[model samples]
Target chain A: MMIISTSYHIFVKEFVSEFRTRYALNALLMFVVTTLSIILFSIGQESPSIDVLSGTLWIVIFFSAMSGLSRTFVAEEERGTSLTLRLLVNASSVYIGKLVYNFALILVLSVIIAVSYVLFITEFTVKTFEIFWLTILLGSAGLASASTILAAIIAKANTKGTLFPVLAFPILLPLLLTCINATKLATEGAFLVEAVKEFQILISFTVVMIATSFLVFDFVWKD
Target chain B: MKTWLKIAVSVWLTGIIIAGIAFPMVKVPQTWYEFPFIPGLEEKARNIIFHVPISWATVVAFAMSMIYGIIYLRKKDIDYDLRSVSSASLGLLLCILATVTGAIWAKFNWGSFWNWDPRQTSIFILLLIYGAYFVLRSAIDEEERRATLSSVYSIIAGVTVPFFIFVMPRIMSGLHPGSLGDEQGKGPVLEFKMAPNMLMVFFASLIGFTVLYFWMYSLKVRQMRIERHVQQITETH
Candidate 1:
């Protein structure tokens, strides 16, 4: 109860700070817009298949994550509030709080990207909205859970910006692959039950990532 | 390592190599020395003795690195950090060797150097994971922080290994032997049986390469220890 309450407090703090300056949100939105337009312009008048569009949508979300999500911890470090947070909050609470924040952030980013992707890409149509939404939800959860701990890890590194994606891509490969497949199936009008395997893998992946991050975040957080 | 162990490893690996290369692949095996001809694999099946073992060693090395990382986190001993890094570097080397050898074998068998097979994709991901591990290690300037952070990163990476190397590959259909729908597939490589003599050499190669990995890991740790000691001595003076 105590941990939950503390983490909730921290989560609220994170949102308040994020909304005040809109730094991460603005950067993330711009990244998504820029990449989507660039992709749209380059493939002008050629209708790429659903496969390519699905891949491209995830790629946009992923790079936008790489660009913007690190701010959760990196901002705290930059503002010199990490010490205060360390002294005031336990490591697990800080982790959970930041994880929730990242989850919400990534969820919003993915939805925006998904909406724009469907609107902009003529060939990309989702016959099954159920699987498509489920994929987005689970993929964002997995991405956010995986990247939160990684953000903490990279916060201590010298090359903060480049290290996040370098450290993130390989670890996130399994998740990305499953998300792409599920999205592909969703676009092809597959039934909800048709993506059972992908759903299982995605759920397990997110659970394992979150559990391991919880176990190891202490080591990464403390001196 | 002891002198006798080193001698045994050297001799054992040499014998395996000789047997692996010199052993004849014949259609019928009347004697213990001759291996049964595995259709499609033919002469290329010899790679199982050499290539498969190296990949096995790679797994062992990465597992060891993860183990040592866990130990370091628990004990806060820099020595364990050294051990972890040493094993990881060795794992990376063995992984590269396995990939290159597999590629060469694939060129003759699959008609392409890179098939993007499930196994190939998994190994490629493993390489990226560890490569990122090293990059993470190098980006930290402080000793204890670097050790702790990298250990945590390695543990996270290690947890995902089974998913990448084993689960994902088998779940997806591909050219790999154990892949889904491979049982009834056209490739005889799926049903290829290993003769008893060939199996013996394969196990022997696995054991030998694993021993060699430990030897290399110990040497690396010792070198790093000496370097750390020398730096401390110089700094004090």
Candidate 2:
């Protein structure tokens, strides 16, 4: 549909803008690497099971993603042109654009994280590794949707600086829970059939959040 | 200054006081507690007395505030906006009370006041989300912007509250009740086992909290209205 194509185009543009922005990509990579190293050092040369490292992988990815998300709209304010951008598009469009862009960023970051998690902490078998990738796909979609909406809400506020994550994390709690559970089950080689409920919960959380944000975002977006 | 509203509140308060006095004096119909309570659970039955009602009432209040927020945002009416915030503030108050009571209940039933279990942790997160909402409101200065932004945030934040509270912990490995999403949960059916007087206590709390929500909501609307009138008069001179 026209709507989908429009959002996809906007989403691509949003990604290019963010990718060109300095520090977000680099800082996220550094944070992910640092967290992996820290966990490796903490666990030592001892071969902790992949099961143990799985949740940590998602946690660090989430926090790093969160750190980037915390800055999403704020940098625009300092430059003083954010108001122009809002004037240019539908408010809901901005949210969709930011969400797709952030989703892609997190997906890439999570893959790199999975790789580092394997190298530094545990030897993830190919099977568990693939599941880890899928979990991140689901989880990152969730993280992106949550942060993008909250980013819009706080975009112009006095505390635009801090409101992003404080409002987001609590909302993201269930997604975080689901991602961890799915990763654990998958690492242990439990059948996807067994983890169906957890998967459903994550998917439902993503769908509901996206729908709710779409409906209420316009009335609430402040200039 | 409304005679009927004052009389209603007094009557409600009197009923609440009487219910409070009579509940403990009356014995439970057949004590679910007549059996041996586990190490921390002698008071488990008492949780139904406080926790469930408070959360139910708070969620009701929060939902009402959400409706007002939508109305205000749609109309840009200042009175409706103030009503939204006041109702939200009342919702937040009830959220805190619900959380504390749930914590107390958790201590008795789960043997620890804080468990990373889904139900307890999720509600705590709900409280946190709403707390941050208040923080968001207070940080702003312009009444129009503040009310507009917060009303929007409230609806968004409201969605997150239930998502986190009811969904997250169960999906994760929390050791709390209601996480499994099954009919056969661990606790006794919270609504049953009333001493008629205890039911009275429960209903009384519900009425008191509801009335309190309305009273605070009206007061906030009146205050904002007065401030607007004062501004208009000063400008006229």
Interface RMSD of each: 1.6, 2.1
Query: What are the runs in model 2 whose C-alpha is more than 4 Å off?
Result: A1-5, A19-22, A45-52, A83-88, A123-127, A220-222, B1-5, B21-52, B162-190, B195-197, B224-237
- Give the winner by lDDT: 1
What is the C-alpha lDDT profile of model 2 across B56-95, one tens digit per residue?
7677777887898888878888888767767677778878
TM-score per prediction, in order, is 0.96, 0.82
Per-structure clash totals for the candidates: 0, 1
lDDT of 2 at B118: 64
DockQ score, prediction 2:
0.55
Listed models, DockQ each: 0.71, 0.55
Q: After superposition, how far is residue A190 of candidate 2 from its true place, in Å?
A: 0.7
